[model samples]
Target: MAATISPSSPNYHASISNTTINNLFDDSLTEIFCKLPCKSLFTCKSVSKRWLTLISNPNFHSLFLTHQHTLFQKTQALGEDLDQPSFILKPYNALVITPNSPSLQLGPLENHLSLSFLGPNFEPTNIVPQLRSVLKFVFACSNGLLVYGNPRPRHRCIYHIRNPLTKDSLELPCALTLCDHAGVLVGFTCDPYYHLETDKTKNAKVSIFSASQRRFRVVRIPAFSDTRSAFDVEVFYSETGKWKNFLVSCPKGFACGFFLTASSVEHEGKLYFMGGGRVLVYDPYENERVASVIELPRGFGEAYRGCLGVSCGTLQLSEFPISPSSAFEAYSGRVWELKHCGKGEETTTTTTTWELVHEFCLPEVVGPGFEELKANESENVKGCSRILAFHPYVRDTVFLKFGDNIICCNLLTRRFKVSKYGGLSLLFYPVIPIVIPWWPTPIPALPL
Candidate 1:
């Protein structure tokens, strides 16, 4: 009924049809592609424009992250299960970049990369050429960006708001005039209400820095004469770029020592300070108002001092009901939940209840002689021993510091394992081109 097609036309048609088939399965194919090494992943991008797009999409990026996390979990499981214990104490001396977004991969680099560890003796190892030189203490990372602070004298004690994955860093200047004596830099996430005046004119207040500024000016807080007691400080965000501080009363003679620790978490548009066995919530915008204090469980009042050592100011909420409320404290070998609600807010007045959810105590995995250190016993030790929470999607993982040794705990399973070697700190890098389940996959499904 129609003109016969030529042999050459049929061959061309078949080639086009094959490509369409590949495009249809691009998401699945990209997952397979991300498993390859970073260099190899780059090379595979040239296979077709469709492949390139699939690799770059944020959805596909999430797939890669998930794969990487899966691989890491698998590796850790294998190390634990191995009978011969072929593990090597290789030092990973590089910047640890953890992304806030479960799907977004940092930089153009793959999810995981290897770096030379400098060791516990503070010896300098051969530098990895591809990695950055600036060593930053990264606390919390989100949306492809990281919240880091440099404690060195050379860097002027500034916080580097950066995206290591993208190699983009922003230097946020210290808000305090006395940067040298600034107890600690606490970062909070709060939503400040912004209002405009009448007469059709916009009321501009504090100015935050734009990308062009590179370095943002510090938001000045009113100075206090008492140096012995630490002040509860927080940074609030509004429509404009400015920092507003809200101060809360502290215990007498609590300032000189490390009593108050900053938190990297922003809960319900507010920043929190943990100290004196209490959680004080502050609203940066409402400077005139008093801070709300949430009392800790009775047992935690004394127990917190020992287990809550090494104040990095980073708090991670557990997935399961570790405590009565969704909130729980992570430190040392234990995971504590809010057992009872004390007299405080309207929320607390109604429910003066105590509920036992789950308690994860560190297992005696460190050999027979090591007795489980009580919270009080460990408090006497010196130096920074922090607990870092790594959120890689479904499972919540926590890092514990006991003296120099670092222990990693899988919150989902409540299993604990120690690092191969002891070091000052442990940072998790999300964009180093390694396979982690949280990383984005190569190809993503399109929206219907």
Candidate 2:
């Protein structure tokens, strides 16, 4: 009835029945694969040519993204001990990556094979014989992508845009003109509309991240200008893969000194750069030529250090004044929130105002070494302190640094705790905070 089959025969396994997975339709397969973690989906590509083909399809990516987003909607914030303490500080000195990616793993046959951090456009002049990789100096982060560049001055800088979650790196073409380090400002922003509410299942808010359909822009403003505040700004679009020059001159008298050390925050659909006692607002998506500027609550001078960040869906700025303290011998940083003060929300940047939100002190919870300063009321010499960052999701939590010691203070509770990540470079490599949304962001899933 049946032909005799041997082990070497092509039809030897024909008599065996296929598994349920093999019988699944492409759409059905994708639906199931979407439920699994992203890392597992990547490994599934090795199962068979059919599985690889299904996962590689662009349509499959869209569906998977939507389904993952649905799962996110079902989850609740602050449900666990992690009141979403999910934000991470990405530094320029560290090219931190997950060791779990299959493509990033190094093989003994090829020593030091991975240099994706440097981007594809630039070539390194020298490398250690046994070194495995070279790190980068990260400039900015938006959505889930990162912008880092080559550090060698001789090599200038070839900027690289990276999706840390996907390991996708696009090497941007060299800048037409390198903005000098004196007072240059660089900012990154991703389109929020691409991540708008989709999948008519849940009443979910738009995600703080964009993936699969994400489009971003990298803005580079010219160096310091003492004359008029007008300058030709460069805008890079990921869709066209090109840079277009545009002039932004909204309000004059906008000056920023040592802007390279300042931090920028992106809220709603615009980027807010705080420096020179002013906040420069730029919308890379909608407004083509308008760059609105906002005045700070208090003029920040050399005696004070400032850090800008967003918390509770509003913009919050912290100022660390190395000045005299009215209360305890040791002074605490002052927090201010940008408020819409006028009659209605119709006010622009020029009309908006900042209100003092909270004044926090370093709690003794951080242990010893602070009593001497508090006891020495006359030694009003303010210890070297800095406002590191504000908690992205937390209401009133902010990170501070006193020399090498890192402390996290909650303005609501007036308490403080030392951060594990201390002794970082106090000068060049400032630890920039990148917020991780509830579900898709990597900081929560991956170890720092």
Candidate 3:
């Protein structure tokens, strides 16, 4: 027979006091707090003075940051199964932020850097300290460097590159002469590499800002012309810092009108882009001469419009299949594979092959469901019908419309993850709300 202890007994206080809360080593306390979900950490902060001091320490703050990033990656991987709409008809104009605490609210997007959040019903109290600006452009972020720019055309079009985390900003002098060109378009990207002998520190390269001094730097390809029947010319990233020139050189008399949508997929040690009826691959260090271009799958040119004018679609690369040898590539309209093949006699070739994996149609466009939803909204939702694409770097593909909601399709399992949100114009510029993933690294050679 054993004696039982009750909370009402005087011995309860003895038991509690005997086991000192402060006696728990710092490492043990940290491990326990780290294991708790982000929501619980907030509640635990108020539990005791010891916990409050432990949680508020800088070391713990760093741990929480790492945990938050890991959670984001995991959540993004599972986003395909979220409860999204069958057809996202409305445009998502609002910025979404994901914080460490689930109960924390997302603040407004006015003059502030908005990090993406994982929960619904955003609140205002949960905004982070570093992100407080109406971010204009995120050039590149890698390691700890984040580059961003705001085109102040009225005052010489200044481009600002800054790391929000470190609060380090480099204002690059305008690369172009204001007198020569009427307008300029600034773009940024990063390339990750692996060196056998060197440590990982030297592996990644990023192109934050480039200036066109004398001539307008345009992607040049031979046997291509500016004709209406031909595919339009666009720039793409093959390596971290290099841009590949793609010319939509359709056959001479093929009466095909091509619209261009561009997106990048990182596989193995290279980054590939799909656009204008062709897939282009680039290796940053090894292959420096030219990018290898492969023709799109049969009938891809005829299925849908090539691209959404000048507004390039999103690109997401994921480590799937649970093997280091396997990866998945996704674009706005399609998903494919970046396969490594044996080296031939003269050349070592890596090919980008499309499998025609998934095809999706918006629910609002297919039925009267959109009309009923629109009628029920507050004040008439005034927006045109258009297609929006999202590649969340994990699961399958998602397509949204200006008035329709969000719809995701799994590439490997061939299933639909249901979630819905109203859509907006397809022609609107996409807001890449997060910080640029790479910056301050050497610029990779652009494809010639």
Cα error, candidate 2, residue 2 (Å): 26
What is the Cα-based lDDT of residue 250 in candidate 1?
Answer: 45
Number of the candidate with higher lDDT, 2 or 3: 2
lDDT of 1: 0.37
Per-residue lDDT tens digits for candidate 1, residues 164-203, read 3333445453543332332343443312112112333443
**CA lDDT scores, all candidates in order:** 0.37, 0.56, 0.36
User: Which candidate, 1 or 3, has the higher TM-score?
Assistant: 1
- Give lDDT tens digits, candidate 2, residues 232-331: 7788777777788888776644665544347556677578776556788889888858777777776444413777877767998877753445545245
RMSD of each: 12.8, 9.1, 13.2
Query: For residues 98-205, what per-residue lDDT tens digits would candidate 3 score against the true structure?
Result: 232322222232223332221232121212341112122332233223334333334333344444422445444443333111222223334321111222574532
Question: Estimated TM-score per prediction?
Answer: 0.49, 0.69, 0.47
Model 1 segments more than 4 A misplaced: 1-144, 151-157, 173-176, 180-182, 188-239, 245-263, 267-269, 283-290, 301-334, 339-398, 402-404, 410-414, 425-448
| Rank list by TM-score | 2, 1, 3
TM-score-superior candidate, 2 or 3 = 2
Candidate 1 C-alpha error for residue 372, in Å: 14
Off by over 4 Å in 3: 1-23, 36-80, 83-147, 152-294, 302-341, 363-394, 402-404, 409-426, 431-448
